[model samples]
Target: MKVTKTSSNITYDIEGLDAETLLSLYRNMLKPRLIEEKMLILLRQGKISKWFSGIGQEAISVGVTMAMQKDEYILPMHRNLGVFTTREVPLYRLFAQWQGKASGFTKGRDRSFHFGTQQYKIVGMISHLGPQLGVADGIALASKLKNKNQVTAVFTGEGGTSEGDFHEALNVASVWQLPVLFCVENNGYGLSTPTNEQYNCEHIADRGKGYGIESHIIDGNNITEVYIKVSALAESIRKNPRPILLEFKTFRMRGHEEASGTKYVPQELMDMWSAKDPLLNFQAFLKENDLLNDVDEVEIKEAIVHEINEHLEVAFAEENIIPDKTEELNDVFKPFDYQEIISENVFEEIRFVDAISESLKQSMEKHDDLVIMGQDVADYGGVFKITDGFLEQFGKDRVRNTPICESAIVEAAMGLSITGIKSVVEMQFADFVSSGFNPVVNYLAKTHYRWNQNADVVIRMPCGGGVAAGPFHSQTNEAWFTKTPGLKVVYPAFPYDAKGLLATAINDPNPVLFFEHKGLYRSIRQDVPKDYYTLHFGKASMLKNGEDITIISYGAAVHWALETLKNNPDISADIIDLRTLQPLDTETIYASVKKTGKAIILQEDSLFGGIASDISALIMEHCFKYLDAPVKRVASMETPIPFASQLEQQYLPKNEFEAELKALLAY
Candidate 1:
C-alpha cells in the first residue's frame, strides 16, 4: 500500500481495486454531483431554502467511505453527500428531510443537514464544525472498550481545523490510541477565508505531528489515490487503534451556500480548481483507461438522473409534515419506568464528594460501558479528589484524565452516549462549564428532540459560591442550563441526596447536569445507604413540616434554610429541598405552599433571572388562591462572587433567606 509520487499527480498501488469497484466509486461521485445540481435548481425555483454543494470534493467522500466497513460510524459534515450515498441512505429520505417532512430522520424537527439516522451508523452535523471530531473519538473509544473492531470517520473542512475542538479531539485520540480517522477536507476556502488566512501551517496534516499522530496529505481529486491511502490507513487503525489525520487537498467550486454568491471567490482561482473537479476528472480517467465506454457513461448518468428525479418528484409531491404541538413537549427526555427504592438498614457516614465517587464506581461496576473522563480525574483523583483511587479500581481506560478541553470532553461524552456507552464528564469547576456551553446547549441538549437520539451523558459540575474560590472558581451557573429546554439540571445538598441523585443521573437515558456544591463537598457528611438506590428526579424532600410558612430551596441554599429554621424556634415553616431543577418539583412546592399559605423561594445564584424567579412564578400560578401573602424570593445580589471572604459571604443569600423567611412568617 505504498504511494508513488509523480510530477503532476499522485498514484497508488490500487491494483487490487477491480473495474466494478472503480465504476461504483465513479457513480458515487457522479450521483452526488447530479443531486447537488438538482438542489441548486430547486433553490432557484424557491422549492428549497438553501444548499451547500460538494461539487469539487466528492472524491474524498466516496473514496474514504468506500474504504470504511458497513458497521463503522460516520459523522458527516454538510458537504459529505457522497458519504451518505455510499452508506446507502435513500435519496428520498434526504429529499424529505430537506422538505421538512416527518418521514425524514429527524421527523421534520430538523431540516437540511442537521439530522442523522441510527439505522445508517451516521451522526449528522451540528452547526459547529469541530465538536463532532471529539464525538467520533468517543465512538472509537467505545468500540475499543467493547472489544468491537470499528473505526469512526469524522469530516471537517480546512476552516474547522482552527477550532479548539480539532486539537482536543486529535490529542485525546492519539493519547488513547482510539481507532478514528480524521478526514480534513481542505477545500481551499472556509466560507470566504482561504487556507493561508485561516492557518499558518503549510498543510493541515502538518499539525498532526504536534499531537504525535500518523498523518498523510493526498490529492483529493484523484479517487484512486484517496481510496488506496485511506483504505490502508483505516485497515491499520482497526488493528492498532490509533487516530490518523488525513488531509485531502481539494476545492469547493461553488460558494459556501446558494444565497452566498461567488462574489467572494476569485474567478481565476475558481477556473483553475473547476478544471480539477473530481467527477469530470474521474470520468476522463475512466475513458482513458477504457474502463467506461460512452454507452456505459450515458447509462450511468441517465440512471442517476432518473433516480434523483423520481425521488425529488415524490418528495416534493408529499405534504410537508409539521410535528404535532404535543410532540414538541415530548422526547426531551426518554420515558423510564419508575423503580421504587426501599431504604436499606445498613448505612455509612460518608462525605459528599465520596458519595459522588462511590456512585460513579457503583455505576461503572453495574454497567461495564460507563466511562469517567475529565481533567486530573485519573492520577490526581480530580482537583477535588472525588475520583481518588478510581484509576486503580477501573484502570486508566475507563478512568481517564483529559486535557483542559471542556468542549471536547462533553462532545466526546455525547458521542459515546449515542453509541450506547454512558459517559460521565466532570468539569474541573462548574464556572468553567461555560467553555463547553455550545455543545451542551446546541448538541447534547438538543439531540434527543432533533433525532430522538439518547445522549446518555452525565456532566458532574461542582457549582455554587461559599468558599473564597472567587468569581472564576465559585459561580452558580445552573440558571443558564435550567433555561435551556432539553436538559435535566440536578443540584444536590447533602451526601445522601448526592449519592442517590448521581446514581439516578447515570442510569437515565438523557443528558443530566449533576451539580455538586463545592462548599458542601467535604463539609456535608451523613449516613447514606450502603445498598444501591436512586432518588427520583423532579421530587422534593421535606426537611421540616410547619403550619405558618414554606421555605423552598436546593443545593447549599437548602442547608442554609434548615439552619435558619433551627435558629428561629418560634417561626414554624415547611422546608422543601428540590433535588432536580429542570423537572422542578412544583407539585411538592405547591402542596407545601398551599398548607402554609405563605412561601419563600431561595437560591445561591443572582437574583435576576435565577431559579428563584421561576419558583416564585410557579407558586403564584399554582398556589395563588392558597397564599396569604405574596411569594418572596431570596437570592444572591446581581454581582459576581467576590474574592474576599467577607464580601463573598455578604454577596450570598444566607442572610437574605433568613430575613425573607421572617418577613413571610410575620406577614
Candidate 2:
C-alpha cells in the first residue's frame, strides 16, 4: 500500500488561521519530543528507571488533542506523549512516574506509560497494545447514556490493529454506534518488523468498513491535517455515535525505548525519515503561515527546556516509589470483616427481581456517583426486565446500555469504580464473565492490595441453573472466584435477603461478586426494604431450627431446602442460609451443627471442587466434635447440567434431605 496525496494542504486547511492554535500545536509537539529526548538522557545518566520515547508520533498526539474539546476523554497509546502532555498530566508527575516516585497518580504502582485518570477526563494509558483499544468505546458508551455530547479519542499503533481486541472493540463500537474515534499512529513498524512484513492490508482504516465503521487516513506528521481530520470525525461521532478509525501515518524519531537502540533500522531508511520529522514539519508550516516569528519561536523552546528541568528536579526529590515491602503480603485464606454493614427489611411481599431492582434504586438515590451499565439496560429494563422502568426513572447516564463487549463492559465498570463512583456492571449472562477475567482478577480484585486505595466495584452476574440455558449459559462459575481473596461473594435466596445483601455488597470497600439465580429471577415472592437496608457479608441466617440434623444452603438451594423442611415434620432438621460465602458464617454453622449433632452441606454446583467442600471442611475443622453421626455433603454430580428435566434432576442432587435426615436420625 502506498500513501495517498490529498488536494488540501496546511495552507489550504487554515485559510486565515489565528497564530494561536498553530503555534500551540507546534509548542506541544516540541515539548514532548524534548521531554522524551531529555528522559533518554536521564535514563543513560541513571537518574530514571525506564523510558519509552514518543518522538515519531508527536503530530497525531498534538493535533488530535488540540481539536478535542475540554472535558472530552482521551485514551492514549504509550507512544502518544503529546496527548498526555497536553491533557492535565503535570510534567512533574510524568517525570516522577519514570523516576519511580509515589507522588505519581497511581501511587507509582502502575508503570509510567500506564497513566492519567478518568476523573481527570484523561483515560489512562495501557502499554500492552490492543488491550486498551476498547476503553474509548466504554467512555463513549457512558457519554451516550448520560445524553452528553462527548467524543472519546483513542490512540493506537499500526501493529495494534492485528490484535483480536481491536476487531472486537471496533465491531461493538460500530454496532452500538458509540461516539469513539480510533486514532492509529501508523509508524510503519510493529516494534522491529515493518508493516510490509506484518500485514497484507493496504490500510488499517479499510478493516473498519467490514464492521460498518466509518474510517479515514491522514498524514500523522502533519499536525494541521491531523487536527482537521479528527475535528470532522469527532463531530460526526458525537452526532451519529458510530465507530470511526483515523489512521495517522507517521514515524518514530527515536528508538522504541531508552535501552532499545534501533539495531535493525537501515541507514538509508533513517535518512529518509529524518526530513519527515513531525516537529520540524509543523515548525515549517507555522513559519510559512507567518505564525512563527523568530522571537516567539526562541521563547517556546526556552520555556519547554525550563519546564522539563523543573519537572526533573521535583520528580527526583519527591519521596515516592516504595520499595517492595514484605508488609504488603495478605493471606488468601483470611476473611474480611462484615461488621461495618448494617441491614434490615422494611417492605413485605416483594418479588426477588424487585428486590435487586429496589436495591439499585435505593443505592442510586443515596449515592449520586453510582453508575449502572450493561447490554439493553438503558431503554430496556434488561433481559429479565428486572431493570424495567429504570432508564425512564433514573435517566440514561446512571442507568446505561452498552454494546455487547463483555470484557470492555466490565473493565469500564472497574475504571468508574476506582474513580470513587459505585459502578454496577450488568453481565447479561453470567457465563460471559470469562471475557473480562483479566481486568477483574488483575486490576479490580487486586487494586486495593496493590495500593492502599480500594476497588469498590460490584459485578451483577445473573447466574444459576434450572433455566434451560445450554452449556454456555447454565454453569455456576462463582467457585472460580470463591477461592480468590479480596472479593466478597453473595447469592440471596429470598427477596428480603436479595435487597439487603445487594446493598451490603455495593457498599463494601472490597470488590463484590453478586450472582443472582436465573431460576429466582421471577420465582420467589417476599417483602423487601423501601429505605436502604444492608446485610452483613459473613452472617448466616438460621432458616428453620431442628434437633435432628443441620442443612446448610444458599441462593436457589436455600428455597429448595425450605420447601423440603416444611414437608418433613417427623425429622427435626435445622436450616442455615450461608448469606455471603467468602467470609462464610462459620459461627452460625458451628452453632447449628453443635445443636443438631449432624450437618448436611448442600448446593446446586457440582460436587467436585465446589462450595460444599468448603462448608464440609469448615464443619470438620470447627463443628466436627458436634456431629452425632458422620458429616454428609450433597451436590450435583460431576457432569454438564443436562437440559431435560428428568436427566437434570437425576444428575443434580434433588431433595436428598429425606433419605439423609432419616439415615442421620437412625445413626
Candidate 3:
C-alpha cells in the first residue's frame, strides 16, 4: 500500500555505494545499449532473424539486475537485455543465441528472450510475458521454504500488467509474503498499442494496493535513481520476505522489434524521450560527479564494441545445430529411468481417494522438499476430501493452500522446478483447468523441449461426471492436453492404478497431468499395497483376457466396460485399462487388436477429436490385415455434459456401450 514516486527533476544524493560500483553500473548499462545497436545492424544485414531493441530502457534492467545478488534469480522480459549483460552471462553464448547457433542456450530451438538457463540463474520470459511473474513467485517461495536469503526479480512491460497472470501472481505472492521484487518496465508501448489504450489506472503501480503489496514508481531513465531505489527495495524484500511492486516509467526508443516500425509514435514524444535516454542521462550524471569524462566514455564504448565484435565473430563461425530426427524426438521430455514398482505383497483394501491421499503422503515423506498446492487443499483438505489430515501431517509449508489462481499455481510449479523442487498441483475440478490452460500448455509443457529445463510438477485433475454436477464441473477433457507435446497424461481407473500411477507421476521429471475421476473416488475399493510402489506410464493393464474382442478404455469408463461385461457374460473380451493416455501404450493396444481382430474403444469424452480417434487410427495403421471388421468407438455425444439425470445418463454413452459392443460382435 505504500507508494513512492521519484521526481523527474531531482538532485542526486547517491548513498550506500562507492564510485567503483557506480562506474560498473554505467559500464553494464552501456554494454547492452551498444549490443542492441550492433544487433540492430546485424538485423538490417539479415545476420540475425529479429531483435527486440531495449535501447531507451537500459536503466531498469541494469539497475535491478546489478542490485540483486549474483546467486539470486531473475526472469527477464524480451526488452530487458541489460539483465543478461549485467548478470555477466557469457557474451559468446548470447551471441550464439542471437545467431541461432548450437552454442546458444536453447540450441536454436528458440530465439530472443524465449529461452532460460538455470546455470546463469536467469529464467527469461516466454512470448507470453505474464506467466514469468508466477514463475518468479515459485522461485521466491522455494527460497523462503529453504531459508535461503534470495530474492527473485521478474520484469514485465506495462501492457503485460493487464494480463490475468499479473493479478494472480501478485495476489499469491502477497498472500504468501514471498521474497519477490516485481519490476514493471513501463515502456510506453506493448508492441504497437500505446499506454493510453492499456489501463485506466493513474499508474500501473497503483494496482499493487489491491493485492496489499508495497508499490513504487521511478524515473526509469535515471540510472542513479533506479539503482538507489531498487537496491533499497530488493534488500528490504530479501530480509523481510515480501513482494513489492516497483514501476519503472520509461519509453521504448524504437519499435517493439526491429521488424515493426515506430511510425505510430508521435515525433515530439519520441524526441522528448530521446533527450531523456537512460544511457545519455547516465553519462551526464557520471560527468557531473567527476567519475567519467568524454575520454573515459570513449574507451568504455570502444572496449565493449571490441568485445562484442569478437564474440559475434565466434558466434557466426559456430555451426547452427540442425537437429536430426533423433535429437528432435528425444528433446521433448527429460529421459527418466523407469523403475518397476516392487510390491511387498502386503495388501489392504482402500478407497480410490485414500489411494491418492496415501500416495501424496508417502511421496511427501519420501521427498522432504516436495510440496502440494491447490485451492482449499490445506485445512479444507480439498473439495473431495482427498487431502484430509495432510495439513496437520505435512505442515503448511509442504501442504500449501493456494488462492483461486490456477494459472499462477501452475506457473509457480514451473518456478519450483527451476529451483529443483518438485510440486504437485491439484485443480479443484478438471473443468476449471480452462482458466489455467495457457501456463499448463505453453510454459510448463514446453520448458523442457525449448531449453532443456525440466518442469518437475504434477497437476492433479479431478474429472468426469456420474453425480450430475452440471456442465462446468464435470468434464473429461484429457484429450486437450494429450494432444500437447512435452506433457504426460495419466488417468487411472482403479484404486490400484490410481495409487501406483500417482506415485510415478510425482517422481517423474516432466509436467504430468494426473486425472482422477470423481465418480471412481469412493465407488471403487481395491486391495493395494500398504507401502510405496510405482507404475510405469505408456503401459496398459489388461484387466481381463479373452479372444472374442478387445475393449480398450480408461478412467471411469474402464469400470463401465467391466460392468457391461458382467451383465452380458456371453461377451468375451480382452479388457485393456489405459492408466496413461499420453506416451500411449500403442504396443499393448496393437497386440490386443491383432489378437482379437476386433476392437472397440470407449471414452467418457465427446467423440469428436477424442483420444479414441487417435487410437483407432493407430490400430488401423498397424493391425489392419489382422482385423476382421472395422474398429468400433463408443463415446459420449459431442455436446456439453448434461445436468439432468436421464439426459446425462444418455449423454454418457455407457448405456449405449452394451448395444455398440453387441453390434460389433455380431459383425
Most lDDT-accurate candidate: 3
Query: Which candidate has the top score in TM-score?
Result: 3
User: Which scores greater on lDDT, model 1 or model 3?
Assistant: 3
Question: How many steric overlaps does candidate 3 have?
Answer: 0
What TM value does model 2 have? 0.79
Model 3 bad stretches (over 4 Å): 1-11
| lDDT (CA) per prediction | 0.87, 0.75, 0.90
lDDT of 2: 0.75
Candidate 2 per-residue lDDT, tens place, 264-343, comes to: 78888877777777777667656655668778889888998999898788987887556565534452212346544454
Q: What's the residue-level lDDT of 291 in candidate 3? A: 75
- The residue-by-residue lDDT of candidate 3 on 119-167, one tens digit each, is 7799988888789999999999999999997899998889999999999
> TM-score, each model?
0.96, 0.79, 0.97
Instruction: Give the lDDT of residue 484 in candidate 1.
Output: 94
Q: After TM-score superposition, what is the CA distance of residue 263 in candidate 2 from its true location, in Å? A: 4.5
